[model samples]
Target chain A: MADPMKIRATASGDVCEIKVLMSHPMETGQRKESDGKIVPAHFIQTFTIAVNGKTVIDAGTGTSVSRNPVFGFKVKGPKAGDKVTVSWVDNLGDKRTDEATVA
Target chain B: MDATRRTLLRGMGSTGLLAAAIAAGVLKPTRVFAAEYNKVAFEAKDLAGGLKGIGAASPAESKDIVLSAPEIAENGAVVSVTVASKIPGTSALAVFVEKNPMPLSAHFQFLNGALPEARLNVKMSQTSLIKAVALANGKAYMAQKEVKVTMGGCGG
Candidate 1:
């Protein structure tokens, strides 16, 4: 099982700003181990953000993203107390989903 | 010695079969779901190929697309990047590190009620030009910034 993500959604006026921090190695296959073996590539491939059960952002990322990535975005309609959900799936089949309420 | 030999043989046998299947186009690189992940764009080796893979071969330069990145990065492992598209009907946004092994770093599709802006961190193998592209009304626009990295990040 992967670690849970940390999500924060704060409303300023009608726009709700969201920030997320995910935990993952984000290994690139090009790296070599100290013993000369190559490390397998493993990274988050897809993620989705939803506000009040409505999908707002459907995204894809490559291995170039930094390890334990931090991502931020904004949505226009959500007000305080609206539910915001986020989910991510990695290349190795690990997945995590977490949610926060707009404040 | 014999046990190690047996394990090695077993590994090779399975990998050989998997390689054959992939070569014959019987399997893909294994995507988790039907999310809007474009395999070709993420695997493209160069800027032109990456742009074409994302369905924007010749995007026009636009001022409405803003790319915010540092002019000089002390560390290549984590460089902050933010892209904002003010185009009225912007639907998608893509970020590209021009010199990375795979130039395309990320792509995001915005649905109704979402803003076309994102902030994230990306790795660069070296100093390179980072480009942000916005798609709107069947057309693509782009903005780029050059970031100087003092240390390389791709190699461990």
Candidate 2:
């Protein structure tokens, strides 16, 4: 299982800023190991963020993203204490979902 | 090792459930994986090809899309970038590094009430033009910025 995603949500005025730090290898399949074998591509393919059960962000990522990526974005209208969930699906069909509350 | 084992078991269980659902016609696999990763887009060698791979052609340069990045990066291995689109009804945003072996770095789709803004770190081979494309009302808008890298990131 992938590591649990760390999420932080803070509200400033009427907008809430959400930051996500995901633990992933994000291997590009181009690197060679000590024995010279190419690493297979394993990276997150899709990421979605929801606020109060309403879908807000859906993204497709590739191996070009660095390992353990940190994504930050702002959403309008989310107030303090609103539920925020973030999830991701990798190329290998692996999935992880974690949630936080707007503070 | 323990985490991997647990994840493997969980993955198997979900796959079995999905298979049963598909067999019973209760779920469409395609719909479940609606946003399939575009290999061609990620492997495109040039900006035009990259855009075409993502189904965008002749994107107009616009100011509504904001791309924020350091003018000079001390390390190319981890260059931070942020993109924000002010266009109403914006649906998607993508980033492409002009000089990288593969230009397209990341692509994001915005759903209901999700703002068109994202921050991510990408690898750059050297100095390059980073382009951000925004899809709004079925039109493609773009913004670009150049970043100088002191060290190459792509295995330099």
Candidate 3:
């Protein structure tokens, strides 16, 4: 199982700013271990953001992203009380989902 | 060591059983949380190949598409990037690091009321041109920035 993500959503003037921080190794496969063995690629491959049950952002990322990735996005029409959900799935099939209230 | 081997064998046994269940239709696999990852685009090795894989082989350069990145990065392992598209009807955005073994870094699809902007951190193998592409109204617009990396990110 993967660690839970940290999510923050804030609304101002009908627009919401959402930020996500995910935990993962984000191995690039080209990297070698201390023993000279190649590290297998392991990274978050897909993620999604939703506001009040409506999908807002769908994303696909490769191994070029840094470990423990952080992402930010903006959306319109979200209010202070709306639910903002963020989910991510990794190359190993591990996944985590977390949510925050628009503040 | 023998105990550890036994545990590993047990884990493998369970995995084989799980696969059998999936194949037998008893445990249907589900990918409800995420859409399919773009393997072809993410695996492209060069800028031109990445652009072609992402279906933006000849994107028009546009000032409205903003790609914000540091001019010099002390750590190539973590370079902050932000891309914003002011073009109307923009629906998707992608970032590419021209020198990485696989240049395509990320792709974002916006729907409903989502804005055409995104911020993330990426790895750069070395000094490279970073390109941001925005798909709008069935066309592609792009912006680029050169970031000098003090250290390479892809090697261990």
Tens-digit lDDT track for model 3 on B1-156? 656644543454324453344336553334333476777789887888888877888999999998999999999999999999999999999999988999999999999899999999999999999999999988999999999999988898
Clash count in backbone of candidate 2: 0
DockQ: which is higher, 1 or 3? 3
Give model 1's clash tally: 0
Give the C-alpha miss distance for residue B25 in model 2, angstroms.
Answer: 19
Q: Where is model 2 chain B poorest over a 10-residue stretch in terms of lDDT?
A: B13-22
lDDT of 3 by residue, A1-103 (tens): 6688889998999789999999899999899999999998878888999998888999999999999999999999999999998988776556778999999
TM of chain B, each: 0.81, 0.79, 0.79
Q: Native-vs-model 1 lDDT? A: 0.87
Compute DockQ for each candidate against the true complex. Answer: 0.42, 0.54, 0.57
lDDT of 2 at B132: 96
TM-score of each: 0.88, 0.84, 0.88
Best by DockQ: 3
Clashing pairs in 1: none
Q: Which stretches of candidate 2 lie over 4 Å from their true place?
A: B1-29
Clashing pairs in 3: none
State the displacement of the C-alpha of residue B61, model 2, in Å, after optimal TM-score superposition.
1.4
Q: Which candidate is the best by lDDT?
A: 3
Candidate 1 chain B, run of 10 with poorest lDDT: B13-22
The DockQ ranking, best first, is: 3, 2, 1
